[model samples]
Target: MFMGDGMSLPTLAAARTLLGQRAGRPGEETQLSFEAFPTVGLAKTYCVNSQTADSSCSATALLCGVKSNAFTLGLTAAVPRRDCAASQVPAARLDSVAAWALAAGRDAGVVTTTRVTHASPAGIYARAAERNWETDADVLADGVDVDACPDIAHQLVHLAPGNQFKVILGGGRREFLNITSVDDEGTPGKRTDGRNLIEEWQADKARRNVTYQYAWNHEQLLQANATLPEYLLGLFESDHLRYNLETDHTTEPTLAELTEVAIRMLSRNEKGFFLFVEGGRIDHAHHDNQVHLALDETIELSAAVARALQLLDEKDSLIVVTADHTHVMAFNGYSTRGADVLGPSNMRDSAGVPFMTLSYTNGPGRRPDVDGRRPDVTLEEGFRSPRWRTHVDVPLASETHGSDDVPVFAWGVHHEMFSGLYEQSHVPHRMAYAGCFGGGPQACDAAAAPSALVMPLVMALLALLRALA
Candidate 1:
């Protein structure tokens, strides 16, 4: 499955227009890979406690089959947010689809543009009272429950069994090393516990006699597929891989390449596999009000989905594409059919002022005048390019996520179950049923109706052959 972070319906529409316009057509007719999926459904991306949820809560609802409070991962609403003491409760914790699949003897892996222990990926395995507890430094941040609640990175290394997630690939190298040691970028480590988790993982691999390999950069990762190790861990950048627009493809690989490598490695499992790929930084770009960056991230995620489709069996393997939440960016103004989506609207306002075709409810784009009303927004002199910030209605340094329903697109096994609106928590259950995981071992049986159509003809042919004998 692929999760497009902060991908709203309007975002998809705007991006689609730009995509086709760049493809030498009137951009409105094109469809992104997710948009073209056969079965589409809407998911209500809200948590139990709030109308609009953060990644931590929404991801839990997406992966764990339960809605959790904001800033908490892998725990239900019974657990208080940011209270270190209540984090020790057993009922507070919840199991993930990853664990469910692992217990059923299938391999699982997670690939993300953000840190591996970040909110969405952490929902698959790690648990924390606060999502900010990504490192030991954060566990102690503002006197959090360092003892009762371990950091997310720590749980990834120590809490999981040896066979857990045969593959773990993403950024944040220094977060695993000791605080005393310098990171790949020469920054001090964030872990206060003296334990160098990376080295510990390596030692454990050796002691247990598992074929494991570690890659700190892209070059080493490139060599990984050739050798085909049993376990792979790649920690590429200190933070998120650069925004798609800002990425230097020479130094770091794109999200598509990472996903391709992960699929190649995990395909070795004979029992079957479950993979989670997160286009995590799309949300980050939206928060910063960078429209191009967000669109490029979505485009990259769609490419990754296409790559997986090429690698997996369409008849058996199910593919689900969805978003954890929505952003505040909105499409406005009445423009021509083929108008540049990123440029200003075709028509003018009452004051003979043209606003941007794309604007936010609240963001840095709102440059207000003396009376607090935004002035006439116009294209720069001599620049007809469609690249510029959209005007905004409210003033805020960073835009907040939108509280609304997001779309879910699916293909392969049991795609019909995704036809109607459902709570976000139903995602994992439906996927489990479609993929024949957990308690839904026979749920996918009815999906093979087409293959069953040939059975009666084959039976008749067999009886005729026996009569001839």
Candidate 2:
């Protein structure tokens, strides 16, 4: 659970001046990490209790700590409303800490840069209603019943209930076939849903003995074969997989090469796995305000969290990093740490004088010109453009979602319960009580009681000034 891709809090305080560091204002602990909340009063209880921290209520509060509504997933928060009446909704189905680590037998995987049926990796494997309608226009505009909304290509050929996912990589190969199907690299326009979901996940891994591989590129995901079929499925593209500044020349791979081939196919399942990697275009470069493509998708989501801290082991793995809301893009003035985080000498101007790099505090057809050049356009283009800087400024706003407050980082094991201020659906029950699966530390004592005494002495004095800077 170390997902970083559209983390806001002033773009992590302008990406802490490109690593010279700032945020908590101490020192060191850099290598980028953060945890701050308040996403506009948790998005007004996620759009009036239809719970929506967006990214599908932060992927159902980080894969089922429960907090639906915002086009739900997994289900809880009283299910219902898919325009009701599918026998009146309500069966709900909670579980999911990757199905409780595949029901304690461990080994579970989901890597993504987007399109493992989108919406934050299909809210960790299916539960629909427009997280971009995973196709079939997301079950005919969320009225359900496109054979009842399973979708992420029918949950990667059936996931949950004791099928222990070995490793299912990203991208959505056109929601698993039917646009005129044809894989084997001919690349036809598939997705009519003729159920070729990769041949029904290779015929359900040859009658459930499990051991599969279905890649799409990067030399068949680096010539797969980690002893065949640890249940891997790559899906290079069909929608939403392309920004590493537009896939570095395609043939697709990088999200740190699909999280290092999903940590070598879920670390060869020695029963110690629950992986979910998503850098999801940092929320499409903050829904297109494109701050240099959202700081190069937050530096490739911190290079996939430095490739999961170079293959996990921070004391029996826990990792937790976070983000599900925030995006206003800030950096009030001042520069010179590492600078050049893509232009305008990092930024200044307004007599503090720096001079243009990029800007936007408000959007959608701006105006104002008493003969100052660049105006005369308005082809029925209504107006509004508060000369962009940062923070809210509406009128016809599109580049949205900024209820400010996002930043959550942790190292490992019980990560001191993600230090400080919570409630974006109590971050998946504080990461399912740091992976022992809930009910631990008295079930996150009121959400880890205000960052338990100032986030470990301020992240141990900023990790000793980022290890002696």
TM-score of each: 0.90, 0.31
Candidate 2 TM-score, true structure as reference? 0.31
Per-candidate local distance difference test: 0.82, 0.61
Error of 2 at 241 (Å): 10
Q: Who wins the lDDT comparison? A: 1
Clashing pairs for model 1 are 21-27
Q: Write the per-residue lDDT of candidate 2 for residues 2-24, one digit (tens) a residue.
A: 56655775675555444443243
250: Cα error in model 1, Å? 1.2
Error of 1 at 92 (Å): 1.9
Q: In model 1, which runs have C-alpha deviations exceeding 4 angstroms?
A: 161-163, 370-373, 376-388, 439-469
